[model samples]
Target: MLYQLRNAGFTLVELIIVIVLLSIMSIATFSYLGFGAQIFSDVVGRDQLISQSRFAVERLTRELRNSLPGSARVINNNRCLELLPIHASSSYLELPQPGQTNADFVAVPPDNYSQGVNYEGTYLFVYANSEQRIYNSTTQRKVISGVTEQDSTLIFDYNTTPTLFPLQSPAQRYFISTGPVSWCLEATGEIAGQQQLVRITGYPLANSPDLAHGDAQRAVMASDLYNNIEGGQLPFFTIAATLQRANLVEIDLRFARRQGAEPFIIHHEVHIPNVP
Candidate 1:
């Protein structure tokens, strides 16, 4: 009976073998779990980048599609587009009168406040780091200092008079032109260690209120157009406009993603149906 009971129990060598097998299995399982965790983290990061890019594109597109003619103006020598709301109480449309040598505009008060100039509506004149800002009118404020000295190109395209006139010229000739005007802007510089290109389109809204304060004015119509392009690809985007006798305008926009990052793009377009 004693021999039978001893035989039934596991041998010391058998127990040792079982313990070694369990340890090996545990190590392999932990290694696999670690690998799986890393993969999951990578996938989540990629998804987040994609979602952010999509949201940006959708917002930009909606704004551009609603652009109106004669509602857009270029300030700071065409560095930025001054956009006005379609229907507003204030006289929001103001551009430097053509033919005037001065590069800035004078802020007409009572009808407009010089202090609220930046907020009442002004386009940010951003080049590299310098920002030359203005009011609803092209009135110049203190030049934005601390602009970084970087190699970059800013381009502006406008369908104005054939003659390249000076700023501060007569309003009739520069402000209320007989035809539509289109302006295109592009900037190039290093952002975050990568070379990038930024482009924008300006569409002027026709029937915009004159600088006169007595009459409620509609804001200028314009769009962001394009912002930052990398990797030699032109980024996918679209622009379209319609010109009637009352309205004149143009639109430009695009989408792009940074290099070595997940692919993403943002698009914007502005259209003003009634400008004449």
Candidate 2:
């Protein structure tokens, strides 16, 4: 039998159809991949934001709990919290003997030395007489080891009424210095520029509440701080205290994104120690 060789290749129409099918499938796959990628990115970004916000709140809470007496106060329409932070908190030194004056001193342990407990450099100091936090320059200059009741190292004399001299039985009082680690909102940020919470270190060189208009020492503690008026949260920082009395601090934080989902709100109420 005379057998003829048949064409093994596909027809032109078949080839065209296959190409079209492949193109369609490729487009669908790419679209799916892109959607998946976008979802993943959103989830990661949201998680990061949540974690950052929580961390910021936790850190602030810890510091507030141990804040020096009469140091924590809300200012700037509750948009700021002014406080003389602490270094290595320690028990107040013992009272001096008869006719002996003991300056402001804490018998800090050797281990805490690394924490910059000494008053060698600029630091925040709060003592027996502090109804409002003030930035004292002269006080930052003197830092002699050991407590001397007379001529204390810590700053005394405040513009506020009923100025404080050397505290009586100060050992029971609370005095804290930011000790290099301070707090400031950033001058610029991705979202909350000049308003983002930051951690400042070794700041307030001359000791003055008049914080620099634009400081670079601040490190971002949180971004997108909510200062809205919707939740009855007046300012970012609010303080309620009496002269040489108890203080009530209210910190309202809200984080909302311009894009993506809605933001979150966090509130913390902090009361200083040594309430008499």
Estimate every model's Cα lDDT from 0 to 1.
0.34, 0.52
What is the clash count for each candidate, in the order shown?
Answer: 33, 14
Predicted candidate 2 versus true structure: per-residue lDDT over 115-220, tens digit per residue: 3234433332434334423334332222333322232323222232222233343354334354424454432445532246776554443334444445435567
Superposed on all Cα atoms, model 2 deviates from the true structure by an RMSD in Å of 6.3
- Regions of candidate 2 where Cα sits further than 4 Å from its true position: 75-78, 88-129, 133-182, 187-195, 205-210, 213-216, 224-235, 242-246, 257-261
Task: Name the 10 consecutive residues with the lowest summed lDDT in model 2.
Answer: 155-164
For candidate 1, lDDT tens digit of each residue in 156-262? 22322322322322221111111222222333333343322222233332234222234323232222223343433343322222333323223233323343354
Task: Give the range of the ten consecutive residues with the poorest summed lDDT in model 1.
Answer: 125-134
Instruction: Write down the RMSD of all candidates, one decimal each.
Output: 15.2, 6.3
